[model samples]
Target: MNKQNKHLPNFTQAISQLIALPSISSSQASWDQSNQAVINLLSAWFETLGFTITIQAVPGVKGKYNMLAKLGSGHGGLLLAGHSDTVPFDENRWLSDPLQINHKDDKLFGLGTCDMKGFFAFILQACQQLDIALLKKPLYVLATADEETTMAGARFFADSDMIKPDVAVIGEPTNLVPVIMHKGHMSHKISIKGQAGHSSKPANGINAIEIMHQVISELFKLREKLNLSYQNEAFDVQTPTMNLGAIHGGDNANRICGHCELDIDMRSLPGMKDQELVSWLSKALQPIAEKYPARLTITELDPSSPSFQQTPESELVLTAEKFSGHSCCAVNYATEAPFIQQLGCQTIVMGPGSIDQAHQPNEYLADSEIIKTEQLLAQLIQHYCF
Candidate 1:
């Protein structure tokens, strides 16, 4: 190890400390927790290694935080980014404490072990192996909050227009592979309101459920249209998809259905915009709304992330492919890659651990991956920072 690395925490030590801090970000209020502690701990660790630390609270998000640690100074540097928060875990489903790292059979089990706190350990280990005095360009480590739910930290960072690196690597679990393209995510709630009255006289009140049927039909038409219109063979699905996840309406059979609500989720392709899709959907239902008037409403569930596609020929993608010895591929899942790419940098998601294990009970990262990831990160740092 380089002399500079001697002062940093050991690989497992860092991972242990990170996992012990439960920074679960969830849409449910009971499960959501602040990520400030995680950010503070990372800030301290990075500061000890001669990095300049800047901690910023994600605007509009009450307690979340984002940390930027810069090691060297110059243009066209490399940004190693990861989210500090994990999905809420079910304690009863885990074999042990989800917040504590449990080592058995050469695997470390914890909430964020594979799904990503371990990636930060890899970053620290890689930085430790580097001799900072020889750095030719800057090296940045970003820790953001709320990746599991809203990606609020990444959105705030991208909008701030700070830290413009030449290339960015988002360490989302991919088993050491480079993900060059991924889908976008958007969800909406469609609500229909109508008068409630006895079922004896059907004309006494409007049947919201009947109106909902029309809305559902229009949605199906829109979904089919989207599937026929857009196609990206690189992804597994190869086409956009809309899922009608849930629907609720009348409470009793005795009365006309007073109100109805339908929840839907859509996965869009690379070139598709979230608002455009929403607009298309709204327009598709315009006829029903026109016929019913003042009863149909479409509401966005949350902020949507756009699909991301980094050119396979980008220098970062080529370098990662060459170093990791794996061809660049596409994932069907959405990530913070699009937000980071907004900084005018070539960005790709590459990291340690399998995404399959993420958010699962008893999540673990094989001990073997520890050294392999560290070595790969070292090679990347050498090529980009030095």
Candidate 2:
């Protein structure tokens, strides 16, 4: 709606191009088969825009590629980072085809249109309009894989000797606002093993299910303790919390269960160390270990995505706030910003879609939000790179 962005062409074609490719990262088989299709398309688009592109393959996932493209020749430029992967969607739950971009009124609906693919489209559009002759620093665009599942691509980028920018922007649907801080989620599965016997005789069997209940009770108490310990005024909840996401054990009613497993989710504040949280959980479960010879095994499904907090006065924060015509705020959902910040670059999460639309059926990005994102990105390019 801004006057500055009026001349730019509609981004619907680009969004359609992206939504046609199903890049669901959670399904390994589907991701492996279709990831290259999206990568090849993006690589060609970037190459046409005069960017030198490289497709980096992550280990363990064949055909999944992380594409890095750079424009201009100088260093310390801005990096527009987004994930090419999306969360898996059930086809039966959608009223319309999830893979096709459908426009209804002012919103464009599709599978990845809101969760991320729309943001990638805007980045591509911005790249096509950039003038290398007027740029002061090189611009880097990184499209990573597997952000919905393990964030393996970001972890790989963190360890590699790739392009290190002075500041990084994670294009994760923030509704055009800058998100500086959020909670980190750490998931662990605890497995317990015990003796199995006939249910008729109570003393003869060590019930794994009963032992798991004891462990879960202790975890609940630990959650309350955490609620009392870490509190922040900036966040709405003001404290870290824990949840028992899942519990599984026992075959049938006839026998004592030999194995039981519990899945625990811990959300931490910005200052809490992940290892420290694990250590605290270990200590809490220590008392029950000797009761039933219960074996305690903890395996983290996804490593803690640490919380993000940057000083309000930082250049990146200030620049983003000014360009977007909004103030900085904290979000409850985590982004790839914290991981990117570990690379010694200031990071901010900002983009077109709203968090309300993410991970929901018939998810969409508003046309107005897309236009606003384009204008803000144009201002950012002029101020930082030009």
Candidate 3:
């Protein structure tokens, strides 16, 4: 770590404080919590580095904020971005308290270690000894809210039309590799309504479970069509994919089913819109919905992360690939990179740790990744900020 970086204490102290804070964001009220304290902590650290910090309260959100810290001055520059909130954890499932950092097995275990409050610690380490005065372009650290649930923070930032940096890197746990492309994610639940009646009487009432079978059939057909139509060799799946995750309905086996709910999620390829998937599913279920005269309604469970794809030849992608010492590839997970790219910035998804470790029981970050990320971030800053 650079000796001049006084704004943040040692990495252990910073990561410990971040993990100690509980900022879980979820659609369910029971699991959802405020991120205000986390942002404030980050603000306090950045201000020590002479950064101009802007804490914007996310409108309509109860306790959320987006922190934008700028050092130096210029029209366009590098934006180091990461989300502040983490997903809810199961208490019984963890070996140690998720709120406290655990050092075991030569790894640091805690929530948000790699997905990714830890990335901000890397940013802090990178900013040390930086002659801010010599920087030709401004350097920005954007800590956003609610990436785990709705991406409300990133969406709100894009809607606000704030600073448009020339390049951005979202540290989203990519095993230290640069990811130039990824699929979009959308999840929806469809509720089918019907009247309950005796199973012995066929005409007395409609069977919602039976109706859903037709819905599933049409969905499979649609899925087949989508698979054939969209293909990207960059991704392992190559084609758009959908999963019928869950279904719930009825009470007794002897009684006619009154209602049923189907939940599904899909990942779309670049140049493809999630709205199209929603529309296609609705149309596929239209015939069954009309035949049974049943009522069906759909609700969005996810905030929708659009596909991220930066041109391979772009300066930012090339530079990140070179610095990381890995070729750019596509990831299966969606990220806030699309939202950051929406601000007229070329974005790359790169960070320490593996995606497999994220959201798992007792998630951990390898100790080696810490040192590697610090050095890589310093190089990226010097190449882009100076």
Candidate 1 ranges with C-alpha deviation above 4 Å: 1-7
Candidate 2 lDDT tens digits, 325-347: 88988887777777788778888
**lDDT tens digits, residues 1-386, model 1?**
47545666888888999999989999999989999999998888888888999999998777999999999998989999999999988799999999888999999999999888999988877777777789999999999989999999999999998889999999998988999999999988999998899999999999999999999998899988988889989988999989999999998999999999999999999989888888899899999999999999999887888999999999999999999999999998999999999999999999988999998999999998887788888888888888
lDDT of each: 0.91, 0.81, 0.88
Deviation (Å) of 216 in candidate 1: 1.2
Q: For each candidate, how many residue pairs have backbone atoms clashing (under 3 Å)?
A: 0, 0, 0
TM-score of each: 0.97, 0.94, 0.97
Better of 1 and 2 by lDDT: 1
List residue ranges in candidate 2 displaced over 4 A. 1-10, 27-34
TM-score-wise, the better of 2 and 3 is 3
Candidate 1 has which clashing residue pairs, if any?
A: none
| lDDT by residue for model 3 (173-271), tens | 998898999999999998888789999996899888887887888889999999999899999989999999999999999899999999999999999
Task: Please give the lDDT score at residue 176 for candidate 3.
Answer: 83
